[model samples]
Target: MHQLDPQMPPVLVFHGDADKLVSPRQALALRDRLLASGNRCELHLVPGGGHNFGQDVPAWQEKSRALLRDFLARQGLLP
Candidate 1:
């Protein structure tokens, strides 16, 4: 977290709120740290979602794709 550069590219993060493998608080902390360093970040917490929550769910998969597409478009990586 301390090694981040303010000039680094924007970041988009997605974490499952109910994740067991990794605490959701970690994502919040990361978002805070990135913002504190003057970097752009977007964090999304999936409700009732656990680790790899989108893998087996069709709806989640589409949602994830939409989120990624939107993020990329915002970053000018997609049109």
Candidate 2:
């Protein structure tokens, strides 16, 4: 985070609140650092979700797709 660039492209992050592999606090810190660096960042924390949360769940998969679509649209990366 110390080497983050303010002019870098926006970022979309998804982290599981119950993730054991990586802490959710790390994602929060990343979001904060990105925003502090004048970069755009969207953070989504899935409740009761593990490291690979939403990978096997149909509902979560759809939700993730929708979020990605919206994020790309907002960045003008999608039509």
Candidate 3:
């Protein structure tokens, strides 16, 4: 658990507001846990998006990709 180790690396989470398989609240809960442990966490809630953006919405898909890329760059995960 993050609370047992505050030195863990930060995390970036993405959840769709319209997801039916998994609730967005789960993402928020994990983010809260990470933050409570003094670790950095980012959660991006995609509006009108479903799981994996499988709703066939191009705009939401692009937005999700952009957010992911930005997060990776900010965390030095992308070159």
Candidate 4:
């Protein structure tokens, strides 16, 4: 993780409660670790959402998309 290039782009991480593959806590831990290693990472925990995050389209993934849009807008990723 620490080996990652510092020049990489800022990242936004989203996790869902229904994810059986990986615990939501694990996602949070990774986010923390990234921050600790001086990487910019934002994590959002989606309620009633799963690992697939309503896959195939953004509309299908409102929880993740909404959070990401708000974060990105705050970060000036979009006007």
Q: What residue pairs clash in candidate 2, if any at all? A: none
Against the true structure, whose TM-score is highest? 2
Ranking by lDDT: 2, 1, 3, 4
lDDT of 2: 0.89
Ranked by lDDT, the better of candidates 3 and 4 is: 3
Where model 1 places Cα greater than 4 Å from the true spot, the runs are none
* Alpha-carbon TM-score of each model against the true structure: 0.92, 0.92, 0.76, 0.67
lDDT of 4 by residue, 4-67 (tens): 5556667788777678888998888877877776778987776766787676234547666677
Q: 53 in model 2: Cα distance from truth in Å?
A: 0.7
lDDT: worst 10-residue window of model 3: 53-62
Cα lDDT tens digits, model 2, 1-79, are 7789999899999888889999999999999999999999999998777899886344677898899999999999999
Please list the residue runs of candidate 4 whose C-alpha ends up more than 4 Å from where it truly belongs after superposition: 55-60
The TM-score of candidate 2 is 0.92
lDDT of 1 at 12: 90
**Can you rank all candidates by TM-score, best first?**
2, 1, 3, 4
